[model samples]
Each structure stands twice: as structure tokens, then as C-alpha cells.
Target: MFVGCHVSIRNGYLGAAKTAFAIGANSFQYFPKNPRSMGVKAFDAKDAEACRRFAQERGLVSIGHTSYPTNLAVDEEDMRERTVKHLRNDLEIAEACGSLGVVVHFGHAKGGEPLEGYKRMIRLLDELLHDWRGEAKILLENNAGQGSRMGTTIEELVQVRSLLAAPDRVGFCLDTCHAFASGLWRGSNWKEVAAHMRSSGYFSSLAAVHLNDSVYPSGSFRDRHAPVGRGEIGLEAFSEFLQTPELAEVPIILETPAPAIGGHREEILLVRKLADRQEGVFDLEK
Candidate 1:
């Protein structure tokens, strides 16, 4: 199984890859630029190429995450343009790094009608990708049902994709913490949740999983993430979800709070142990 945590790319692509490897991770996620800003640093093709080569040799998978400042549902002219520009740049960077794809938040409605907000998102994504030809996909991540965020429900996500100009190039990334907080998951019924998603058509487009534990109880609508086995959702739920046959080939990324790389390393080991135990395997050392 592919499992890893979100690693900082401040030291460049190769540096991030090395950090993931050191943590015993076979996969990792990274922000393509500053999460708080729209400014992106100059791309170093050589460094990206080296990182790709190293990841290929080590059987590592990498995924890029878009900046938090991006809001695809914006109705304003200048903000919409900038958001599209930044998103396009993110896709380009992901492609250059040979990443699986880039994960993006569905954006907020700013207190507007939910339907209008979804329409805005569909229009903007169409504008951004209508003529674009990139191998890297745009993976829309589910929200924690906080405020006016879109894509909180599988129905909403499916609706937006159906209206997209390039639905085939778009996909979904499930965040466990968000799922619990949004009440889409009751923390113990992953099988039911998975079945619901599959029937709604979201599961077929799922490309990645954010294997996080929630800081709050189910239906809390809070987006706090805690370390594996140290949160409300607990490790048992994760173990059950990890063994789901539907997600066997999808990469799992940890977005849990960690004091350092060591914290994430421990969580990674714990996840491996959980999966191994469920499968009746005993290869991982305690």
C-alpha cells in the first residue's frame, strides 16, 4: 500500500523526496507553492528531473496540493483570473515533477446560494481547463462542511464534475477528517460510506485519500486533524478503511499534526502495522 505524509517542499522537490524516503514513506503530498500566497518560485527543471528519477527508482509516488488561497468559486473578475492562473501554474508544476496530480479545495460560496456557487465553480474550471492539455489531473478534495464550502457532499461533487468541460481530467480526493466532521462518515461505517460514494459515482473518480484522524467528534463540522490513533476517529476506523478493496491502488496521504518528521514516521509505521494485521501478514517490525 502507498502511504506517506505531507512533506514540505521548501528545500525543493529532491529535498522533499529525500525527506519522505527517510521517513520510510512510499508516497507523499506537497504544496506546489506557498499555501497562503499566490506567488510561486521559479521552477528548477533539473531539480525536478532529479526528484522524478529518485522517486521512480524508489517506487515513490508524489502528489501536489494547490495553495490554500485559491478559490475557484469567486465571482469577482480579478480574483477569478488570479485563481485560475495560480491553478494552471500548479498543474504545470505537478506535471513537471511527474506527480500523480494536484489536489484542490472546492472553494467557498462567500454566503451566496450553494447552487450559484457550484455553477461558478463549474464555469471557472471550464475556463481554466477547456483548451488546456495536461496529463496532471485536478483532484477536488471534500470539505469539512464548514460554513459555505462547496463539495462537502458527494452529490454536490458529482454535480460539479458532470458540468465540467473536462470531467475526465478531474477527480476526487477523500479526506478522512473532513468526512467525519462533515457527517458523511459516522466514524465506524466506512463500508456504508464507501458504498454510498460508489453508487453516487464519486468513488470511480477517486484518485487519492487523505488518511487523517479527526480532532472533533463526528458531525462537528470542524477541520482539525490529529495524529493516527490519537484522535476521535481512532486507529480502528483507519484500519478498516485501509483494508477496503476499492482503495487498494490509491495512494494514502497523512495530513495529521506532527511535531516533526519523526511523528509522521511513527504514524506511517502504525498504519502499515494496521494494514498488515488486518491482512494476516507480519512482515513489519514493531
Candidate 2:
């Protein structure tokens, strides 16, 4: 199973891969640029190629995450242009580093209609992908239902994809915390969630899974993430969710809170153990 957590790219792409290896991870996610700022650091092509080779040699999966400031649903022309520019840069970096794709948040609607926001997002994305020739895709992430955020529901996400000019170049990244917080899943019945995703055609486009536990109760609409098995979502729910047949081959990325890399390592081991239980390969009690 491909499982890992978010790692820093401060050292470089190869450095990030090494960090994942140190933590017993076969996959990892990273921000292509400063997540809180608009500034992007230039990367050495040699280092990027080396990182790709290293990851390929070790069977590692690396996924890029777009900066948090990008808002595809923005009404302001300049801001929308800047968001597209940043996304283009991110895609370039991801392609260089041999990443699966970049995960993006469906930005907020604020004073605008949600449908309009969805259309705006689609239009902006069409502009972004129009002339771009890159192997990395754009993976939209589900929101936690906070305020006017788009993509809070699987149906809405599916609709957005249907409207996109290049639906084949765009996909999805599912976050367990967002699913619980948005009331899409109540920490029960993985089969039901899987069934819904299958019927909505979301399963076919699924690219990755953000394996997080929610810090708050279901339907809270909060985006707080907690370490696996240590929050409201609980361990039992996670174990069952890990065993879902549809998700078996999907890369699982941990966005859970961690004090340090060591904490992430522990969580990675725990997740592996949970997944292994399906084959009676490990006992949690031990």
C-alpha cells in the first residue's frame, strides 16, 4: 500500500524523499511553494531529476499540494489571474519532480452564489489547462463545508468535473477529515460512502486519499485535523475505512497534526497496522 504523510521541501525534492524513507513511508505529499505566501523558490533541475530517480528506485509516490492562498472561485480579475499563474508554476514543479499531481482546494464563494463560484472555478481551470502541456494533473480536494466553500459534497465535485473542458486532466483527492466535518460521512458505514462515490462516478476519478481524523464532531464544518485514531473519528472507523476495496491502491497521505517527523512515523506505522489487519497480518492489541 502507498502510505505516507506531508513532508517539507525545504531541503529539496530529493531531501523530501529521503525524509519519507527515514519515516518508513513509501509515499509523501508536499507544497510546491510557500503555502502561506505567493513566493516560489527556484529548484535545480538536476536535483529534481535525481529526486525522481530516487523515488522511482524505491517505489515512492510523491504528490504536490498547491499553496493555500490560491482561490479559483475569486471574482476579482487580478486575483484570479494570480491564482492561475501560481497553479501553472505548481504544475511545472510537479511535472519536474515526477509527482502524481497537485492537490487543490475549491476556493470560497463568499458573497457570490455557489453555482457561480463553481462556474468561475471551471472557467479559470479551463484557462489554466488550455495551452499547458504537462503530465501532472489538477486534483481538487473536498472542503469541510466551512462558510461558502465549494466542493463540500461528492455530487458538487462531480458536477464541477463534468463541466470542466479537460475532465480527464483533472481528478480528486479525498480527505477523511473533510468528509466527516462536511457530514458526508458520519464515521460509520464505509460501504455506504463507497456506494455513494461509485454511483456518483467519483470512484473512477479518485486519485488520492488524505487519511486524516477529524478534530471536531461530525457536521461541525470545521477543518481541524487530528492524528489518526486520536480524535472524534476514532480508530475503529479508520480501520474499517482503510479496508475499503476501492481505496486499496490509492495513495494515502496523512495531513494529521504531528509534533515532529517522529510523530508522523508513528502514525504511518499505525496506519500500516490497521491496513494489515484485513489480512490478519497484525494484531493491534500486541
Candidate 3:
């Protein structure tokens, strides 16, 4: 299994990989710029090349994520434009940094009609994909069902994927915290979730998993992410994810709270250990 965590980009675009390696991770994710800012930093070819080389030498897989504040489902024209522009930049950065894929959030619908909002999102994604020049695929992350967020359900994500012009190039990332908050499944019900995904043809498109523990009770609609095993999702829920045949090879990335330098080491080790055990069966009584 490819296991890792989200690392900071303060060092450099390539510095994320180094941080991942220091924590004994073989894969990782990072944003290209300040996650809360709209300003784009000019890409440096030299840094990109060095980061790409480092990943190649170590056989590490890299993933890029869009900033949290940008929303594709907003009614404001200026915000929508800014959202598209930044997402485009994110793809460019992902390509430059040799990332395999980039993960994005389906924007909240505000007071708008849900179906109409979904259609708008589809049109935006189509436009983006048509103009996309990068090789890295884009993966839409599941949300925590807060307010009027779209793509909180797997069905919604499936619909979005089906309507995209390049369905093969587009994919999905399941955030454990979001899933728990949405009441889709808890850690104990992973096997059932996997079965549903497989039968629904969504399993093949699974490119990444956000491995986070939740800070709220089940179905609380909270987005607070605690470190692995420290919150409601607990440690055992991860084992079910690791043992699932369909998800065994996908990259599992931790977005849990932790210190930048040495924060993710223990969690990374724990996930790796769980993956190695390959607990194929989930006994509910245990």
C-alpha cells in the first residue's frame, strides 16, 4: 500500500517529498501555494526538475491538492472565475512537480438548487478538462455534508464523474473524516462500503484515500480532523481500509492534525504496519 500524509510546501515544491521521506512515507500530498490565498506563485523550472528527480529516484508518488477556500459552486461570477483559475494553476503545479493526481472539493451550493448547482459544477469541470494540458488526473474529494456542500454522498460524486467528458481522467478521493461526518460509513463498516463501491463500478476509479480521524460524533457534519486513532474514527477502522482488495494499492494520505516536522512519523508507521498485516476479514464482534 502507498501510505503517507499531507506535508507543508514552505520548504519548496520539492521539499514536500523530502518531508514525506523523513517520515518513512512512500507517497504524499501538498498544495502548490497558500491554501487560503488566491495569489499564485510563479513556477520555477529548476525546483520542479529537482523535485521530480527526487521522487523518481525514491519511487515516491506525489499528489497535489487545491486550496480549501476556493469553491466551484458559488453564485458570484468573480469567485467562480477565481476558483477555475486557481484549479488550473493547481494542475500545472501538479504536473511540474511530477504528481500523479490532484484532489479537489466539490463546492458548496449555498442557497441554490442542488441539481442546478451540480450541473454548473459539471460544466465547469468539463471546461477545465477540455483545456487541461497536464498529465496528472484530477480527483474530486468527498465533503463532510456541512451546510449546502455538494458531493457529500458517493452517488453525487458518481454522477459528477459520469457527466465529465473525460471520465477516465477524472476520479475520486474518499476522506475518512468527511465520510464519517456524512454518516455514510464508520470504520467498522468499511467492508460494506467497499462492496457497494465495487458493485457500483466506482472502485476502479479510486485513486486516493484521505486517512483522517474525526473530532465529532458520528453524523455530526463536522470537518474537524484529529490525528489518526486519536479521534472518533479510531485506529481499527484503518485496518479495514488497508485490507480491502480494491483499495490495497491506492495511496492513503493522512490529513490529520500534526506537527510539520516529526508529526506524521508515528501515524505513517502505524498505517504501514496495518497494511502489512493485511487483515482480510472484518469481524463485527471483535
Candidate 2 lDDT tens digits, 93-198: 8999899899998767868589889878988999999887888999999999987856788888899998988898898999999999998999886779889999
Off by over 4 Å in 3: 259-261, 278-286
Candidate 3, residue 164: the lDDT equals: 83
**Consecutive 10-residue window with the lowest summed lDDT within model 2:** 277-286
- What TM-score does model 3 achieve against the real structure? 0.92
lDDT per residue, candidate 3, 55-108, as tens digits? Answer: 999988889888878766767777777777778888888888998878988767
Q: Which candidate number maximizes lDDT?
A: 2
- What TM-score, over all chains together, does every model reach? 0.94, 0.95, 0.92
Model 2 TM-score, 2 decimals: 0.95
From the highest TM-score down, the ranking of the candidates is: 2, 1, 3
Per-residue lDDT of model 1, residues 188-224, tens digit only: 8888888888798888999999998888999999999
Better of 1 and 3 by TM-score: 1
Better of 1 and 2 by lDDT: 2
Q: Candidate 3 — what's its lDDT? A: 0.81
lDDT pick, better of 1 and 3: 1
Residue pairs with backbone overlap in model 3: none
